[model samples]
Target: MGRETYTGDVAFEVRGHLGMITLNRPKALNALTQLMCESILIQLQDWAEDPTVAQVLIRGAGDRGLCSGGDISSVYRDMLEHQPRDGGGLLPESTPSYAAAMPAEEFFAVEYRMNLTIAEYPKPYIALMDGVVLGGGVGVSAHGSHRVVTERSRVGMPETTIGFSPDVGGTYLLPRSPGNTGLHLGLSGIHLTAADAIFTGLADTFVPSEALEELTQQLTEHPVDEVLPRYAKHPGDSAVEQDAEWIDAAYSAGTVEEILVELEQHSSSYPGAQQAAAALRAKSPTMLKVALEAIRRGAQLSLSGALAQEYTIAIHALRSHDFREGIRAQVIDKDRTPRWNPGQPETVDEDLVAHYFTPVPGKLLSLE
Candidate 1:
């Protein structure tokens, strides 16, 4: 097979029969930008049509992380300029209309399309996930045919922390998780190690972090169907069982507030549960409610239906106050103190949660 190059900030390299797509911005922990997403989609399309490319291997450049999330810092700056300051106030005279247009429905349309493409790609796709895999990273990795995790792999749907419901097929996958693990993780913004990921069905296989290079080499040399048997080893008992007691107790609650209250009440008995509770307590209350609702509703939906449902929620979330404020605190200002809408989970009404999933006129996600 001949090697070819695809140009972008993302490092696209083809060697042997496999094309490796590496998210290359190590300084930002490989946070994905719109350009990176487009570039990847283009490359995947090209490779999908090419006969020589036997498989696709997606990974990150450095050892620090896979990808932290989307480049929300840029999106947040744009949101501040376009939307009203408090109520319905107009943007300042100096604000650029281009910046204000960023949270455009088009972005979500393109991003969700990319995710759906990955999910339905003709060729085998393998994601070598090591280190942080959150938010948009989950979109890229989890959609693959084979998802490889390492001891260093830390996975989560941390969108609620930033006042966003889980997007990019999260509605589909999270609801598929056993028991209420998906609902629990989505609302709590918890991180799971490789072992935890495997137990929870988030990762297809586990490889030692030290063995990643060898695994990559094997993938480059062999077909993906054979790569696992050639180099992969059996994983140990998953870490999901470690938190079984706490997860069952807290996650079984009917509402987000009830879950939090349960966590707070049980924190003294389990240190891990205490940490998880603290993290959930710190996230956006509105996002938590929406995420919980999304998972609950998504559980009853087909894969495509869940994606369509998530499309509505995602578009509405962009126009909501909490999404921008959460991004400002977490990504832009780096203050780590989001002034969440409703301020408390208990204050968020069920109607507001339902509003997120309500369809917008002519805004349906076209899977075709």
Candidate 2:
């Protein structure tokens, strides 16, 4: 089959009837931009019906990361320059619209739809997940028909760290995590190893980093339906199984505060859990609480339902005081100190948190 490069930034090739798209921004560790998201979405649609393209493989260019995340630094800069900074301290204003008169809202709308499309793709889709799969990265890879990871894979739903409740279908996937494991990961932004990824049901297979090229070759040579069984002969239990005790104990807490207390108390006994709790403590407490609620609610909804719910929370979060502040502190100012409202988890009230879940007018997600 022929090969083509879209915009030259992303490499698209068809080898052995498998359409492969590689995120090419290795310098930025393949951090996704709006352009990249749009390109990939369009390509997926084009190839989905191509009779010659029997399977699709999505991967990163370099070894650093599969895709780091959305271009947050750009998003923060845009928010500060154009939009009116809502001073009422309830929700922040929406992001400035792009030239097509489409705001960040449309960006998210299309991005989420792309995510669902990958999840439900008619043809087999494989994600070669290596390092630093966060936020937007998770949206693309986690929902694939087959997600393959290496020991270097560092996966997470880390939206809380940036003052956003997990977007890009994180709300849906995080809650679906076994038991409360989803809740814990969503709130804390903890990174998971390859084993952890498979254990949590986020990845389908684990292979050593050295075996990646060989595996890619195999996928190219074989039919999509035959690849999994051929690769299933590897060793090692899933990541979750290795950390079962700690995950179950630390995540079982009823509330975010309770989870922190338990983690602090058990830090000496479980270093990983303790470190995770400490990390959560460092993030915006309000964001953490919202993330928890999002995950819990998302777990119960269908994929389309979850995306619709997340759209409301996302638009509301855009107008939140903590979001802009979080972006300022974390990305723009690089101050590393955010003046969060309800700075502590206990200070946030149920009604205040409820505002984020309020539905937007005519904001239904299209999952076609």
Candidate 3:
């Protein structure tokens, strides 16, 4: 009967039949933390069963973005403090004694589980995806039933730039995009405009940034299906869709190496083709190969299956040299130059790639 509000890094409020979630860490662009993930999951579960809650909406607190990604700085710190032994003889962090103590592993597990929840949420889950939505941001918004993007939206999964492959359901969602646009975006870690986001199937509608507040008011009073029609507008043309011929042609190649060759070959006709190749060339070679493989394999798997597979890869990546170096260059040191171990995509052998999929002992994701 009365308004209810809860607050922290994540906030929750109940207005009329609409339950709302606000990612509260605007300074960090609402970068998700383990506690935030757990909090969202708990609230989602509660709302899913509450008859009074007809639907739910998630938005970021500040104008910066919906969510930048997971709090990788925390993950970086945990890995640094608990560096695995060289020969892999270290005891398992998932062991019963240290289960709750393993922050990095637990963060991935909780975040991935929250992603799965969004994908399968019963009630309409509307996401106001304004500003910079990357990596973990994609997981939260893209999975929602009603994903709205604005002109200011800059969405992508940029894990490869940080020497890590995409996670938090990126493999499942990106591969399902039109043609090879997903592969191109995933490999290159490029941002998409609102039009491009809708074209790529990441967003359902486009609403002007200024209209979001009024739209929210409408949503509180009426159902999303009824309210969205009033605010959804044409986001104009998607540049990615215009360049789909080159993007699909280049990205459909058998491997990362061949994909580059295709991009280079198409450069004469398409201005962005050579740039795409250069972007791919700049990212961590190991992560590029791993990301490609995960996306390819993800296409054949269900969201849960893809998430499970990603969990293994994420655990393996925690011990990878590239992951740490990536965070250092991109986030900590701001060097913008990460010296990836393999250095070349061709040097990332299949055997080494296969090792990433090997399940970690005591760390399997039990997503039903």
Candidate 4:
């Protein structure tokens, strides 16, 4: 049999019984695009049915890491040029048409579906998370049965910082993180170390960055379950573990207001908590409330259910001033100064928060 040919930023190659995937755009930190998601999903789906394929391995090219996340700049542009939909009467006058928005809407809808695929993939999906893995990057790597991280790994769902809540299955994944640390990370947009990733259940094994090449070579020649074990090393100290007590105390409150208050109370003795609180203050308040609620609801729901809830919030967020402004400052303008509308977390009323979960007037996600 002859080898199949493929091309683009995402590439696939079959080596012996192993199928391998590479996110090739190292310049942008391998930021995912719709094409990459489609490539990954198609390759995995194909590999799942192929009996000759023992397992699959995925990694990013370049030294930076696996991937940063979805291409937010592309998504933001879609929202800006978005047209109206459903006879154009459903959305508010000021709100962008979530139904009509190109790319971002389609991106999330497709990206989330891809995430579910990984979560339920039949064969072993080994991810080499050697660098900055965030947003959509997490969706791809975190769901796999055998997620491997390196000392160079830095991971998180930093949607809040971009004036957006974490999407790409973050609603499902973050809540599942250990001891309310998920909530703390989701709200604060903090990056976790490889050791912390293992502690938080994000990655299964810890291997040195340099060992990845040998691991890949071994995977190409043998079964992943047998090969990965030989190279696995103990991921040393986890900062998140040391701070878990402080996190659960500060972030477990019922509301964002209460959470911030608790963080303030601990500010004197735990400067980390104080700093975390201050970081939360810089993000969109409306998003903060919505993110917390989504995570809480996610803890109780299945992956599909959590994804459904997140879709609603993502649609609602497009209508908010913050999401747009957040992207403009942090991404477009590169100013790092997002003038949040509500200014304070307490000012965002519960009623506004409720609107996020309201049924979106468009096609529903076909997760099954």
Report the number of the highest-lDDT candidate.
Answer: 3
Q: For residues 1-368, could you state the per-residue lDDT of candidate 1 as single tens digits?
A: 53658655698888888898988998998988878887888889999998888899988878887888788887776666667657321222244432344454666666777888898899999998899999888888998999998878889888988888888789888878777677777877788888778777778888787888888888888987777866566767665667777788888998877887888888899876788788888887777877888888888887677788888887676667888888888877889987776887778777787777777666678977
Q: What is the TM-score (0 to 1) of candidate 3?
A: 0.95
Off by over 4 Å in 3: 84-101
lDDT tens digits, residues 165-206, model 3?
A: 988898998899999999998999999999999999999999
- After TM-score superposition, what is the CA distance of residue 329 in candidate 1 from its true location, in Å? 1.1
lDDT of each: 0.79, 0.78, 0.90, 0.83
Q: What lDDT tens digits, residue by residue, belong to model 4 across residues 107-192?
A: 77888888999889888899999989988889889989999999999988889998788777788888888889999889999898
Please give, for residues 1-368, the per-residue lDDT of candidate 2 as tens digits.
45765645577888887889999989887877777778888888899889888899988997798998877777666555644565524633243321112255667777788888898888889998888898889998999988988878899887888788888888888777777677777887878888778767788787777877877777777875676655653536654565567777877787888888887877888777778887888888888877888788887788888888787776666566777788888878899887888788898887777877877555556675
User: What is the TM-score of each predicted model, taking all chains together?
Assistant: 0.91, 0.90, 0.95, 0.94
- After superposition on all CA atoms, how large is the RMSD of candidate 2? 3.0
Q: After best superposition, candidate 2 residue 330: deviation in angstroms?
A: 2.7
Where does candidate 4 have its weakest 10-residue lDDT segment? 84-93
Q: Which of candidates 2 and 4 reaches a greater lDDT?
A: 4
| Cα TM-score of candidate 4 | 0.94
- The lDDT ranking, best first, is 3, 4, 1, 2
Query: All candidates: CA RMSD in angstroms?
Result: 3.5, 3.0, 2.8, 3.1
